[model samples]
Target: MSTTERPRILVVGGGYVGLYAARRILKKMRYGEATVTVVDPRSYMTYQPFLPEAAAGSISPRHVVVPLRRVLPKAEVLTGRVTTINQDRKVATIAPLVGEAYELPFDYLVIAMGAVSRTFPIPGLAENGIGMKGVEEAIGLRNHVLEQLDKADSTTDEDVRRKALTFVFVGGGFAGAETIGEVEDMARDAAKYYNNVKREDMRFLLVDVADKILPEVGPKLGAYGKEHLEGRGVEVYLKTGMDSCVDGHVVLNNGLEVDSNTIVWTAGVKPNPALSRFGLPLGPRGHVDTGTTLQVQGTDYIWAAGDNAQVPDLVGRKNGNENAWCPPNAQHALRQAKILGDNVVSGMRGFPQKEYSHANKGAVAGLGLHKGVAMIVMGKMKIKLKGRLAWYMHRAYHGMAMPTFNRKIRVFADWTLAMFLKREVVSLGAMENPREEFYEAAKPAPAPAAPAGAGDKPKAKAS
Candidate 1:
């Protein structure tokens, strides 16, 4: 209860790790024993796996994100970014959304700032490409794609229509593949209502520099996914890199060229570069170097997990590969967060710290409605499935993994509604610039009758 002397746990970033870790810590802590504070740029933690569905309108955008304040009611959630962490002084410099920066002292720190989009210095990428990292981006992409359909539908020029209907997605990982599939399905459905637009008229391209797609599910399933997409009229170009997309003129390494108005980039993600300012020892690839205990190397009070930490994979180590690290994905993130919470509590109470370890379960991905691919690992058995059955498996697994019961019900409701009603093809593109019409109307009325009489009087006053 002491204001200045209470043990303070500072959680940086309110994404997956930050949210679950804080929740776990609070649950394990005795009444008012320690103070937990979470800080992030956004107020909600986005469930990234459902982002594609949100973009495709299978689920509402709001349901895909969990509000940090509402879920972590017992913890203090601050909307800000941790600019720098001074480990020696046990203080972190926090730059809030508004106001001057201040230092917050903490007894323990959790660095879960997560990853940002890993981008190359490709020309025009910054100006022309869109990302799918957040709920906002998903909704924006949905609107943009629909808006493009509107453009193509209304245009008479063949060149303009061609450019408008061409959609290019760079990267063939889970994100890129799932996104293109969902959005393409939505577009195909939307074409039914448009007079000029048809599914065949639209060009959907998936380009990746890698030789294969969906590498997480192994070669066999990956090949099946590639074949399935190609069968759906998608042009899957492997080992193809983008040369430049300047002004939407896509030039590919395979000597292919296309004019497209929409370019979606889901190449990869890198740990948040902000880790450097924290003064923690980072790996060569920029992730905070973490041991099997999920604690930062050489530091007892600082812990890290999720996409930002280079956590050792104990399972892999036991298999005789010592240098293997946990891949940055939802499965590991969720598990590491719970273990991290327990470790933090144990370390505080002088209890022994438990090392983090887990074997790979498998991977699953949904490709639009009634279509998916899955790989389940059961000891020596590896179960691979596709089509409607795999689609159900994907939903069951992720639906259960989604953070809270509230979200589980909402997501299931969205799916239930979809079964009876047709997919919502309407796009609220105006949501992005909702105030445009209002701003035009609210413009100050023309100089109220600064008529000839007022002008003559002003000239007389000049003397």
Candidate 2:
């Protein structure tokens, strides 16, 4: 394998866009056309839509992520991050997970390092906040929620119990809504097993600055979602914001205050900070400015897509905004990656590039175990549904979208089994500390173990 003989295509991230784009490009190209290399900090690409279920014990967190190495067997997958890109020299500085950072030269580049959780300067958020973006966070949240039950059961102090039982969720988008709903369901089920805890004992608070939640769904469906959540004893605080959560004391802008230990922050996501670091032309929100052809503005060989690219949405119109840009969501990201992959190939082969346009199919969200809201747009007709049917729709849509059939079947099996079995509410918080059991067993004995059959005296010698 000589370097001179291979034309290299370097992908910066191994997320949804990066993995799918690389797979599509490799599938289209000839055997020896080019070498595709993907760099990412994580070894697997998580199907983020299942994160809520993963957190709520609906699906195993391990089944929500697909291993990059197993999926992209032909492509060279490097576990690393692209810290810097030298577009002029066609090289990128990659910091490997285990080794020193090195420069990797490529003939072409694909920027798909997806977005991160958008956070505010609210006090105590950095240390106390739990995000719902990836599998690790989802699993951590599941443990945290269950561990809270354990704390409440063991503690006699009212303040500690109240703080442990109260859960505060910021933001009302899909992440925040779905997460709080699933967690509430889990807590309700978990209470049945606890001696002191009851479903009424726990408090679920959802806060959003906007007047409504689930903005992806229309206003009517959003209202239905709010009603469903409120019916489940969830406290919905809209048109308000959190002033501070300093040391777990939450003060709302609407003159409400509460003390809670668990604060899950799912406010929103901003474009990847890595985009701005690349010195590319950025849109107002710091997303890379790309033409409809999916090529970075003013660059022939460089391309971008997914959440990092501000692509034009040709379907909608507005008075002041010209060519409404696509919202950063899974539906758009999945579609954009396909076109972006093809356009990159077209550029490499000197073929004509086509514009990318997609009419949104609509949005769906699961509110709890058997409740949800969905609005499907079909030929100018809007279909709205709620309750168990909508919940099935949400699961059906994302179940098929869970990438590999292996994972899809596993997730479906999880749901199928849930029909007959009660949900698992026990928290394995020790999972985070793999060696904790060993440490406990290895603890120094309060006093050396007495010799077998010894009764308040030293054991006699065998002699």
TM-score of 1: 0.96
State in Å the error of residue 253, model 1.
1.3
Candidate 2 — which residues are off by over 4 angstroms? 1-4, 317-321, 440-463
Judge candidate 2 at residue 335 and give its lDDT.
83
Measured by TM-score, the strongest candidate is 1
- lDDT string for model 1 (180-226, tens) is 99999999999999999999999999999999999999999999999
TM-score per candidate, chains pooled = 0.96, 0.93
Cα lDDT of model 2 by residue, 215-262, tens digit:
899888898899889989999999989889989999999999999989
Clashes of each: 0, 0
